[model samples]
Target: MARGPAATPNPTVAARDGMVLPAAGPGTGTPLAVRGLTVSYGENPAVFSVDADFPPAAMSAIVGPNGAGKSTFLKASLGVIPRLAGEVDVFGKPVEQARARIAYVPQRASVDWDFPTTVIDVVKMGLYREVGLLGRLSGARSTRAMRCLDRVGMADFAHRQIGQLSGGQQQRVFLARALAQDADLYLLDEPFAGVDAATERAIIDVLRDLKAEGRAIVAVHHDLSTVPAYFDHVFLINVRRIAEGPVATTFTPETLQATYGGRLAATHLDELAITGGA
Candidate 1:
């Protein structure tokens, strides 16, 4: 266990504008690799030198405190937010070149629930990247969308307006949308935030299914207790990479304190499990 902080920038990672990134090795079995990734808001760096590899067919959690750049790292990796430095690779290829293989679900709060869109309509939006904006959703595509909704246990809500549903329902709708994308990798920000216990279980079931199918699922998770139960890997970040690897070994109390400071005393593994139904 290499403790403390991440090592100095590896020479293998190429330099871009003075930002050194970790190079993707051949046959590393990792779908995603980030090297020396740095993102800044004006002069303040949101994410400093970070490096990690996300294995294929696994669930990984990005854990950190507020303002720890969890969301910033996700956006920067997807190129939705411009990174001040570093590089991101998907399947050993640049993110831009592998765009179609990735799917993203932003925070529920970040979306406007008031948007006059049906549940099915929102799921269909996932196909827009593949089918194009003007492309029509034929009977086949519409059926596919319905199947995705069914996966998230929201088939009955397909006709309901997004805003009319409860918070948990809304989150399921977004998960269904990501499922419709049919991408190789999924990046979700706070998928369980503000959702009921039922919704949390439903989402976790779907994510586990995705991992079973040889796809990668990376999520920004806040609950420390459930992390060990939910994910196979943990990537801890606090402005910089604190520790990243298997949850059992890397997600230690020491790393948690290093990432969240002294206030994380309550992040224990024996708390009440929310994986049960509501």
Candidate 2:
């Protein structure tokens, strides 16, 4: 039998990420395409016309300095924004129709940390899509929720209050929540923001596993240093597209500077580092 990284065969990915995805069926392997994408806040344009596609079965990192519109782009792709000028297509189909096949992990900082909730209770939200908006949860769904928590090393904290968890632990919970959805496309915004190295590695390992499953991952990441080492595909964007390609090509300093709006000093990068995002 022929084999790709996951030994499926017919897998044709070229991210140079050393990140390989499982063999994906041709029918579900369509990439996420954005053309003439423009997002704005009132009269102030946030993102200019942009064009690109996240190929299926690849890990793509979106990086830039502060105010680069990386998170805005993710919102546009998901139709969460009020008005958008560009077109977003997933697997050559409209994004709205592909909702069930996609999952989203917004920044940990954006969540109401003080809100009263338990770890497992948070993850149970992920199953809502599959169980249905009105679907009652059987024990099966609850079991799956705990299993997902274990996957991210949060099994012990399943009953702990979400506000009490550390930054890294919280981030892992976000990953687990998304995994519980079992979607084909994953869009994460600053998942590693405020996360410790160990937590970062755990999150990365989960993304890698998802890649191995042939799902597409798009992360809004601000850590420029890890872009090359962590992602196979990179999209450097400011208000417009600066550079996009395999990390080997798009992770260069020139592109970094352009994407961040001129040369960024070390101090500036530190400031741009996301602690919490909404």
Each candidate's TM vs. the true structure?
Answer: 0.85, 0.84
Q: Which stretches of candidate 1 lie over 4 Å from their true place?
A: 1-29, 266-278
Candidate 2 lDDT (Cα, 0 to 1): 0.83
Prediction 2 TM-score vs. true: 0.84
Question: lDDT of each model, Cα atoms only?
Answer: 0.87, 0.83
- Give residue 80's lDDT in candidate 1 (0 to 100): 93
For 1-278, candidate 2 gives per-residue lDDT tens digits of 55656764455565578765544454454568888889999787788898887877889988877887899988988998844688888876788888878899998888788889999999999998788878898899999999999989999999999999999999998899999999989999999889898999888998999999989999998876677567889888888888888887557656665676556875654533431110
In candidate 1, what are the lDDT values of residues 1-278, reduced to their tens digit? 55333553332554878876556543223688899999999788999988978888999999999999999999999999999889899988899988778889999999899999899999999888778867777899999999999999999999998999999999999999999999999999999999999999999999999999989999999988788789999999999999999887788767777898865655342232223111
lDDT of 2 at 103: 92
**For model 1, the run of ten residues with the poorest summed lDDT:** 269-278
Say which candidate scores most in lDDT: 1
